[model samples]
Structure formats: structure tokens, C-alpha cells
Target chain A: MSKLNDWVEASPERERIYAQEKLIVDTAEEIWEAMDKLEVSKAQLAASLGKSKAFVSQILTGSRNMTLRTLADIASSLGKKVCVRLLDAHESNAWQSVDAVLISRRVAGFAEVEVSNDPRWSNVIPLHKESCKAA
Target chain B: MAYSLRIAHAVENISRNLLVNLYINSSQPMDEYHSGSSLTIWLWEGAEASWAEAEVGVMEAHQAQFRARLARLAEFGRLRVPDHMNSEGDGIHAVKGNTGLRAYGWFDRVSGRRAFIISHVVLKKKQKLDPADLAKASARKDSYRLSKESK
Candidate 1:
């Protein structure tokens, strides 16, 4: 009956829930990557874990907040273990030190060559700059 | 006489460095208006997942929605978020999914182009963003800017 132009904005509570959802998604991805490395499939993983393919699919898509028991079961089946750490302020400093060196290296490397050679190309190219003026 | 030659050589070195910096600064602006140059996404060392990898880490339906939102961000030069989602004028933008997914990052201009650098990904269980997460993102933005300047 009603048509909305943009997606509905999230409430504070919804934001929190989405945050949890993101965690499940990230965990699911890790599990998927492990399966890939181990050369396993959802069907294979399901059989090994004595679970159903549908359940595995749900887990991978973050349809539910998986219990630690389920996660441990999945990890153990895949020859892995779950390690959780709550970092202290000093310890968590390591997370913030997301070394941008790699990114900068890529940019600077390109700049060294491109900027040095052409002396005209921008260090980074803005998308939609030519078409849109506001940005 | 020998000292004079050495002094002249030192002046030449300083001048050469200055010229290089000037040349880089002058040339970057002209290329800004060119079409077809795509935006760049940089992940941190420990955040070692390709954008595709990160995309696959969510629900099947949400993945498409996430991508569509990203497309809008690229088109608009900034990702859209509810006004309440912003972190107090810190330039950080966030997108919240109806399902459980939130992406947070800040925008930085590189050579007149905007680069959206993600500070952290959160899985919330509470009603408010952890102040620490905001700090982490802000720190990352600062580090990125500092690195850019040093270059």
C-alpha cells in the first residue's frame, strides 16, 4: 500500500541486533573459509557434524545466533578449536594498529610510477566526480 | 673553494626534493574530473578479508542489499545512514540492515577522491555503540591521514 524511497532507518535496538548479526556473519565466513581450505562442502560438513545441510546453510547465512556448543561442534568437526579473547585496553591497542602500510604501499607504489611518469594522474580517482557535482 | 662546491651540491639536493613534491602536488588535481576511475577499499592488516569475503559472511538476501547500498555509496560519494547513526560529526558513516548487519567507516579524500576506510565491524548486543569502537575508527582515520601526509 505504501512505497518508500529509501530503506527504513534502524532503531537503536535494531542497530544492536544488527551488530550481533554481523558477528554471526563474520563467524560464519570463518567457518566457510575453513571448510574451503579443508576441501569440504556444506553437505559434507553437515554429514560430518551429524547435522542437516539446511541447518548448515542457516548457520552460514547467520540466520540464527549459533550457540557456543554448535560452533565448537562445527569447529571440532573441521579439525579446529574456538578461541575467544576479551582484550584489555593495552591488549586491544593491537587491534587499532591496523597497519595501513599495505594500503599506503599500494597507493604510494602506484603514485611512484603513475605520478612520476605522467605527473598528472590523481593519487586516487574519485568515483562519480565527473557526473555528480555535490560530492 | 672546495667548501663552496659542496655547499652548491647541498642546495641542488634541497631544490630537487622541493621540485619533486611540487610536481606531485600540482599534477594530482587535473586528473580528478576524469571518469571511469573507481574508488579504492583498503583493509587493515588483521582485517584480512577481501570485500567479497566479507560479503559472503552475511545472509544470502542481506548480501544483495549490502551490495546495492555500496553501489549507492559509490555513486553518491558517501554511504547513507540515518542521522542518528552518525558518530557526533566525526565523519564516520554507518549502514544498518533490517536484519542484523551494520558497517561503519569514515570517508577521506585522497587526491580529491573519497576513500571509505572501514575502522571496525561490530556485532552489537546492546542499544548503543561501544565508545571504544568509535575511538578505534577515529584512530584508524588519523593514522591513514598521517600516512598520507608523510607521503
Candidate 2:
């Protein structure tokens, strides 16, 4: 195990703190991404929410505790929606790997269908295209 | 040369060598995810010592947040949030938090693999980062580079 893993696993308190901080950082990062995508500056966001620029800065910098209402408000201001997901410990770490596998499978299926429809593969798998069409 | 000046130079050399040694010995990949694309995050010994000196709960929380940010940088190849992480020019970047904790480092190709090597950590008391702190971090970075090139 890495030193970080060992440190986190050494105590339940440490793990709890780590999990909590991770969520906060993740949520803050999502909001930042949304703001960037929408070209919304912190000052603009603060103005739209009728709050001070410092308040918006505090929320983005993880200085203030953000409530669900605050998150909803920010999302509404940015014309975005809030999404919350709860994953088990195992799934939390491996979600990307699982998603990558699922994505690769979907892409392979599409490639197979495309290949089957190609004239080069018509003689090799004459019935494959018909089966794909029916599916 | 004056005795005091000679002694000062010797002490400086010793400290620089010690820092370089610490940089070499403390290099480790942060295990935040199982992805193969993760970049190695090297925590300098000084940074670890400073982090260790923090209050237990605060230390754990900051370390967690820092690790998460590094993981995101590793996975995504860049962190879009300038508030969380930003380049400090000349290839040096800072991973900062609202709690006034900042870890300064630079990216370099280590052993032919890209890595973000943390040179030092500082807890800022002022609203603006003291130029001295950045200079110290930059010095450490230069020392690390010189040592690497010599090897």
C-alpha cells in the first residue's frame, strides 16, 4: 500500500475525514467546471445570487460549508442541475475502470456492426448484417 | 574570506544537500485510484514534515484534499480550477487551499515519466504569498534539478 493508503487505513477517524474532504473537493470542482463551461465569473455568479463576491469565493475555495440549498441556488444561477451519487467504497474507487470497460464494449459492438455492413465483410459473414439489423 | 562567511556557505551547502537527499528518498506514487494513467505525486520530505506538524484533524483533512486534487490532476492531466491549483510561472505550480495551506512544486520528467515533485509546503498567514516563500521553493526546485543532472 502507498503511504497515503496506510495513513488513511490506520484509523476510522482518518478515513472519515478523508472521505468528507474528498466529497467537498469533488463538489467544488464540479461547480468550478460548470462555471467555466458557462463562462460565469465569480463576481457574476455572486451578482446573480445577490450575494457578495467574497461569499462566492468562499464557497468555491471550500472555506464555507455549502448547504444543499446553496448548491441548488448556484446550479440554478448557472443554468445547470445538481447531481448527487452515493457509491460504496469499492465502487467509488473502481467506477472509472468499470465505466471504461462498459464504454469499450459499446464501442466494440458498434465497430462489429460497421464491419459487418462493409462490402469487404459481406462475403465473410453474409448473414451478420441481417442479424444486426434485426437486433 | 571571513570566518562567518565561510561558515555560512558551508551550512548552506549542507542544508541543500540534505534537501536533495530528502527529495530522492521520499519519492512515492500517491495511490488515489487504480488507473494506470495516474501521474506520480512526489512529496518532498519537508512538505511531509510540515504536514505532520499540523493538528491531527486538520492535517488529515488537508492531506485528503491535496491527495484528491493530485488524483484529479493525474486522471485528467490538468485541473481546471485555478483556485485549487495554479501555475506560479516558470513551470512551478501551487496546490492551495482556503485554509491557507499551499504546496509548491514543479513538473519534470523523472526517469522518463512525468511527475509533479513537491518542493515544500507553507501555511500562509498573509493574504498574499510572501515572495520569500516562493523563492525558497524555487531554490529547492533548482537544487533538485541540479542534483538530478549531476547524477
Candidate 3:
């Protein structure tokens, strides 16, 4: 294995970061899926949200930090609302391996976990539990 | 269970088996059981959702075909791959779909399961998987094995 792979395979911290980032990326992908289902183009969505197309593109592609306000705006534009759910460890299969860290993160509150192509230093933003609490 | 976890579990099993230092993870290297044909597949971590995105219909068709293959294996004691879609010699069974989409996986019977266990799912865009993808899949299989050994 390469140095990077060896590091990732060995590092619990890196794996936790990877899992958290997967959640964010999956969430962004879900937003893209909603747009696909609604047949809304990025430009159309941007126009409706009073934002630039690039902004919408960036957020949905997981390129930019997805703010709560932004998530709600996008959802409302699509006749939806931003919904967050706390999936139990068993309920979250992809997350099961990294459950220990995620459980800590969730209890610490909802937060942004970034995944860059480089596994070295993805930023971990503090999560505000109030913003992401399940309704 | 999510398909991702299912893949993870299968890889874990394959890795543990290989760690006894007796098995190989490849298309041509592994042995098949007497009851059913075995196959190998590869899946990149975190890419499961995208499997249904582009080429939706083709993806659905391929998924349906995969289901049918599993059904046949369960009912008829055989799962045959069409020549155009299946390839050998890499130690990984490569299944090619129309529109340049491809998947890598394998089937083998495991303990506690009557049907063959389908493991390692690597989604590819080119007809041929990049060498890195193959290496990654192999490394992952080994990682899974290591995890089990430590446990």
C-alpha cells in the first residue's frame, strides 16, 4: 500500500473525518437528486433562489460550505424543507464502522466536516446542534 | 441494510478468508464451490448513491439483470455471464454495461449463507478499469481482512 493508503487504513482520526465528510457529501448529493427529480436546472434553481448559478453549483457539488440558511432556501424553492434526522448507529450502515467518532461528533452537536481530495488536512467546522436538530 | 454495508461485510469476509493466507482476491485466482459459480466485484467507498444517477435506465437495467442473475443462482445452481459483458484474467470479474459503465464483483459461497456471497463493488466509467482502481480494490480487500484479523 502507498503511504497515504497506509496512513488512512491506520488512522482512526482520518477514518472519522472521512465518515463525517461522507455524510456531508451524501447530503449535497441528495440535494442534487432533489433537483433532478424536480427537473430544475442549476441556473433555474439559482435564479429562483436569487443567487448565482455558480453558487448553487458549488453548494450542490459539495465544493462550498453548505450553510443552514442555504439548505433551507434550496429546499423551500423546491417546495420542501430542510429536514435532519438522527439515525441510530444500526440505522446508519455506511457509518457503522466509524460510529464511535460520529456518535461523539453528533453529541458534540451538528457540524461541518470537509473532505478534500487530499486526505491530509480536511477542515472540521464546529457543528451547531440547534441548527441541525431533527424536527 | 444499505448496499454499501453489504459490500463492506462481504469484503470483510473475503479478507478474513484470504488472511488464512490460503485464498487469492482476483478474477481467475479464486476457486468456485461445487454448488454454484463464484464471481468477484469491487465497489469504491462512498460511491453507492451515484450508481443510480447517470444512465439511470441503463443502470436500472443492469441492476435488474444482476438481480435476475442472483435469482438464477439461487434457483438453478448457476450464474452465467455473457462473454461480451464478462471478462477474466484480472482475478476480478468485470461486468460491462452499455454506455461505458462497468462494475467489478465476484460471487462465492460463504459460511452461514446458502447463496454465493457477492463482494467488492467498484464502479467504473471506462470499459476497462484503471489500474489504480484495481489496486485500490485489492488494498481494500486486504484492509477488511486486517480488520477481521485484529478482531
Candidate 4:
């Protein structure tokens, strides 16, 4: 086993902590990206949320614990909505690849397709154009 | 004077051998097609030892935070946030954690694969990196280049 694997398996607590940290970092990145797209500054976000600029800075830096309520508030302040999904361990990294495949299939005129067996492309079903038109 | 010169050469050889043996910590498949830009991460054995030391000294939460940041870098090729990583000029960059843990390294392209080879690790005590640390990392990068050229 590699040293990284050993470090990962050293303690279950480490994994749990890592999960929390990843969520915080990912959420912070998302907020930062949204702010950049919306042309919102830290001071502006703070004004929208009626909070202090330092609080927003803390959120961006992942130095403060961001609860679901805070996340929703931040998203609303930025004129965006929060999306939360619980994905399986395998799907977490593979979902993007599956999405890309579905998009390519649509572009290639394969309106309807089913992907299975392959874990990377698993659990994705592309909707047919007829079905979309009917809807 | 000749004997002293020989002793200096022997010491250099021992240090060179030690530097040549690196303890890598990457989980990416080198040849796999990744949807995201994937870069392999490499750490010198001494740097790894320093990381282990930092892991032992910090809180478990901080250690996990550091690992997760590294995992993101390996998975995504780059950290999206500048706060997490940014170039320090002169080809040296740093991977930073919220708790002030940092790994100083540079990017390399080897065999058509991009890699981030960590030359050193530090638990930074200041908001800005010390110039001495940057110089050491830069010197190590030069040594790495020389070693590769000799090969």
C-alpha cells in the first residue's frame, strides 16, 4: 500500500473530517465563482445578507462553519439558488463523464440512450427528442 | 587538501542519493483518460517526512483539511481558488491550507504528463512566505533540473 493509502486508513475520523473539509472548500469555491459571475464583491454580498464583510470573507476562506441556512442565504444574496445532492462514492467523480457522454450522444442525434454496466457511465438515461416534444 | 576534496565529494554523493529517492503520494491512474485535467503529485522523501511530522503536530481536523486540499489538486489539476494555491513567481507555487500548512513545489512536464513535484513543506507562521523558503525551493528545483539533465 502507498503511504497515502496508509494515511487515509490511519483513522476513520480522518475520512469524516476530510469529507467536511471538502464540502466547505467546494462550497466556498462555488460561492466565489458565483460572485465573480454576478459581479458581486465581498462588501456587496455582505450588504445583501445584512452581514459584515469579515463574515463573508470568513465564508470564502473556509474559516467559518457554513450551515445550510447560511448557504441558502448566500445563494439568495447572489441571486442564485443552492443545489444539494447526495451522491454515492462512485458516482461522485464519474457523474461529469456520464453527463458529457449524454451531451455528445444528443449532439450525434442519438436522442435516446441508456448507459449501464460501466460504473463510469452508469445510471444515466438520455431523453428522446420525441419525448421532449410531447412534454 | 586532496583528502578534504574527496570527503566533500563523498558527502555530496550521499546527499544526492537521498534526494533521488522520492516518496510519491498520488492516487491518479497515470494513463487513464480523466474528464477533468488531472496532474500527478510527487513529493520528495524528506518533504513527505516533514508532512508526516506536520500531521502529527496539528489537530486531526487540520490534517484532514490539508489532505482534502491535496486530493482536490490531484483530481482537478488545479485548485480553483487562489487562496488554496497560487504561483509565487520564479516557477514556485504553493499549496496552502486554511490552517497555515503549505507545500512548496513547481510544475514539471515529464513523458507527456504534467506533475507537481513538492520540494519542501512548512507550517507557515506568517501571512506571507519567507524569502528564504522560496530561495530554498527554487534551488531545489534547479537541482532537480540538473539531475534530470544528467540522466
Candidate 5:
């Protein structure tokens, strides 16, 4: 951990920050897979991201939240694009539609973690507003 | 039973500076038997709070005191608190190789009992608390010697 303690530290740009955020939440396994497939190293990630190795350590160790754009740049470096979509509320459907949604979080060519990407939802969710309120 | 400590603030600081995407959040209570992915230990978190109950950071020396107390609880068959509070990954042992990190805390699903609830964005070992881990217990020996008056 750097001797720092706050997020007020100087940052390059918002676009970069957003990109970094997307990467931070990525699964370590996913990142490892992407890097392994592309033949990249932590040093290369830092060099491409224009950050220090120490900073890269923070990002990889879940110590940082890279912005969406920064994550996109990192992905782009790897030849990937972050993708997203929205699911609206349908009156006829059992589930209520959401007003707005933040669809895809892309990392250029590296990898993507999306709602549709994962297929591990096995539990049934009852569509009851009261239950929602209780939860 | 179990407790969840927030180390996100600390994690955020490190990531913003270093620029990495590793993050860990507790989706299920620590008591929930860890399956392939029960405890949410992700590398990033754009905005989803699925597994992350909160954030996590490295523990300070004093905070290590809390870990020791929590450990004593477990030693007496009470609750075992986790050693590395907000560390990412399964038991510290897995993270540290063989001379691995000591994975503390106990989990009991029979009644949904969790020791320490922890979530971490960064997974670095900050301080070595093991060196002085049991030092305090040994120091009090002189004072805890049956308390001459009580004997």
C-alpha cells in the first residue's frame, strides 16, 4: 500500500478513471485469462495504462477502482471492447421494468463482464413489490 | 457470531493511485460455506454491489488487537475472527502459498454464524502481526499467575 490514504490524490483524467473502475471489479481469473491469452505482463499493463507498477499493483490487488474509460483503454490495448445493455420493465411480465440501467462496461480488447455474459442464475426471484420492500 | 469489517476506503485509495482492478466483496455471509464462488472475490466493481456487502482495507497494528481478541474467542470455543480483515481470496493460506497467510475465523451454517464480515479491494499483506500476535498473552502471565491474593 502506498503511503497514501485518500482518493484526492492527483489523477490523469475522468475518462481514465472510469476505465480503471471497470477493471477493478473484474474477476482476477478473467484478467489472468486475458493476459495469458495475449501474452502480457503486469509491467506491460502499467506501461500501456501510463501508470506506475506500484499503482498497477493496487489495481490488480483490488486496491483501486479504475474508471470505465481507463478500463476500456486497457481492454483496447488488448483488442477488446466493453459492451452493455438495458432491461426495461414490462407490465405484462412478472418482473417490473427498471427506469434506467447502466448497460455494458467494456475494456477495449481485453475482456468483458456482463449480466448476459454470466449464466449462473439458478434461484427463482418472486416478483412482488412487497417482498422487494421487505428486502 | 460473525462480523463484517469495511476496508473499502483503504482499498479505493490504493487503486486510484496504482490503477489496478482487483476487488473482493462478501456476497454471502462468511458463515455460508464457500463454494466455487460463494464469497464474492472479484477483481473489479464498476457499480455492482452483488457480492460486495462493503469495502475493505489492510488492518493497522491496533486493529490487529481486534483480530487477537476475536481469535481468543475462537480458542475458547467461541467465535473465531479472521486474521486478515479485508483481504481478497479464500483463506489467507491460499493467498500466501505454503508459508501462507493464516486463515482465521470459523463458519457455522447451522445457525448462520459468521466471525468477521470482510470485503477488500486490495489484497496485499500490510503488516506482519504474527510476530507479536501472542506476545500480549505471554506478557500478562506474571499478572495472571493465580493472583496471589485470590490463591
Candidate 6:
């Protein structure tokens, strides 16, 4: 839905991809459990990556200034993966059912999220997986 | 151009309270403050989900756009605004910045200094196909791999 005046466009695919960064970072930390969640602050990530703290800070901020090599290492260190696929603008909405965000929520029972246009809203019902009870 | 936004009333006291039915915002400050006619609405105040997860390219674009807007407002010298302190039509006296749209004459909306996710915004009224408006459109956009909401 292109709004001539909205001044904002939500590429369901891109937005969905963007949403994935935080989730990946957070979950990857969980996989690091015993070592104090690694506490890999920008300082640590920088030391390990042999880059400037400021540079690491920019990367952590998800700025456009990242190199694929850096991103790959971050992904590798975090035990995650990165994939890039191009799709047309019109095809974004149809992707609703398969987006990783909604998929993860469904699997985790975090909440059932709906990404829609007409009313245009997103909702996550925090709940326990077993009983489907709100947390 | 005049700008406006629709946001949680709690935006006024975000540090003190939780917003109803929304993701936990990363505590990003709305950046600058200014004035308006009736109430003191904020600009860049609604960086919500999109901007937080926006790519760096998008943020740069927004920054460029914001700078252009500010230059225009600076030309007028004193922006007319409704004053909260005065009963008879005193507002924020100000200029506009590319990022500070809708945030006329006001102050202190940005939250949390460290670990902030940068964001640019769009008011509901001024919304358009402009990529800058959605730069930080959603906090949900910029999730680290495998990270879930507020994990």
C-alpha cells in the first residue's frame, strides 16, 4: 500500500529482515549461556574482531557502512547465518505467512503476530508455550 | 511543511511508564524538541519499529533529508508556536531540522544514552513514500539474528 502522503514505506520483506537482526543477536547470546552470555559488548566484539570500537559501534548500530566480511564474522561468532534474497515490492505482503519473525513466534508461543495493512498493526501476545497463557 | 504524529500519550513520560500494547521501545530519545500551536508534540519522537531496524543506508538518507528541512526553517528565524506558559497563543518558538520534523519547539524526548538504535521519523500527517520517514520505522526491523522481541 503506497500512501502518497504517508512518507513511509514498509517493505514487509525488508522490514521483516530488519526485525531479524535483534532476534538473531539475542538468541545467539542464549546459545552462549555458561559464559555469562559472553557479555560481548561492542568493546569485546571490537577486540575480537580487531577493529576500532567506534567502527564496531557503527556495525552494532546496523549502519549501512558494514563490510560483508565483518557481518559474516559477527554471524559466525553468534552462530547465526545471513542470507540475501531480492523480491519485488508487490510481493512483500504475500510473504506474511512465511516470514521468520512470525514463524519464530509461532514456534515459541511468544505470541501470534499479525502483519496487516488495512488497519496496519503488529501484536505479540507474550505467553507460555505450554498453556498458551499470557505471560 | 507542518508536521504532526499520533503516538502514545505516555510518550510524554516514557521513562516513568510503560506504553500499552506495544513492543518495548529501545528507549531512543526523540532527539530535539520544539513548539506547536495547541500542544508541544515531538519530532523524530516516533522512531518506533521501522527505524530501529532500518539499514544504515536508510538512516543516512533520513539524515540528509532532515538537514535539508532544518535549513528551510532556519530561514524564517523565529517559528510561530503556541506557548504552554502563556494563555493567549504562545507555542514553541522554533525552526525545523530534517530529523526534527513535527517536533516544533519542545524538549527532552530521547531516552537512554548508550546502546541506542538510531532512528528518523514521520508524522502521520506528513507521511509519504519518503524513505526517510521509515528509516527507523520499527524496532522490530533491526533484530540481531535469532533474537526475539526484548529477549
TM-score of each: 0.36, 0.65, 0.36, 0.69, 0.31, 0.30
User: Could you list the chain B TM-scores for each candidate?
Assistant: 0.58, 0.68, 0.45, 0.72, 0.19, 0.22
CAPRI docking class of candidate 2: incorrect
Worst 10 residues of 5 chain A by lDDT: A96-105
What are the per-residue Cα lDDT tens digits for candidate 3 across B57-121?
A: 55333443333333223322332324113544344444443344544443432432233322334
After superposition, which runs of candidate 4 have C-alpha atoms over 4 Å from their true positions? A1-3, A90-92, A95-135, B1-37
**DockQ list for all candidates:** 0.02, 0.15, 0.01, 0.15, 0.03, 0.01
By summed lDDT, the worst window of 10 consecutive residues in model 1 chain A runs over A92-101
lDDT of 1: 0.48
* lDDT tens per residue, model 3, A1-58: 2222333346566545544444554455456556766888889999999999889866
DockQ winner between 1 and 3, please give it: 1
Worst 10 residues of 6 chain A by lDDT: A119-128
CA shift of B139, model 5, Å: 25
Best candidate, TM-score-wise?
4
Q: Residue B92, candidate 5: how far off, in angstroms?
A: 7.8
Q: For each candidate, report what fraction of the true interface contacts it reproduces.
A: 0.00, 0.34, 0.00, 0.33, 0.00, 0.00
Candidate 6 per-residue lDDT, tens place, B78-99, comes to 1221110111112222222223
Displacement of the residue B69 alpha carbon in candidate 4, Å: 1.1
Tens digit per residue, CA lDDT, model 6, A1-135? 211112323445434443344233222222222123345566666676777777754443333355667667765665445444444533321222122233333321222344343321221122223423222
* Model 2: per-residue Cα lDDT over A24-70, one tens digit each: 77677777777877899999999999999999888876778899999
* lDDT minimum window of 10 residues, candidate 1 chain B: B28-37
Q: What is the lDDT of residue B64 in candidate 3?
A: 35
- How would you class the docking of model 5? incorrect
lDDT of 6: 0.32
In model 5, the runs with Cα more than 4 Å from the true position are: A1-23, A27-29, A85-135, B1-32, B36-92, B95-151
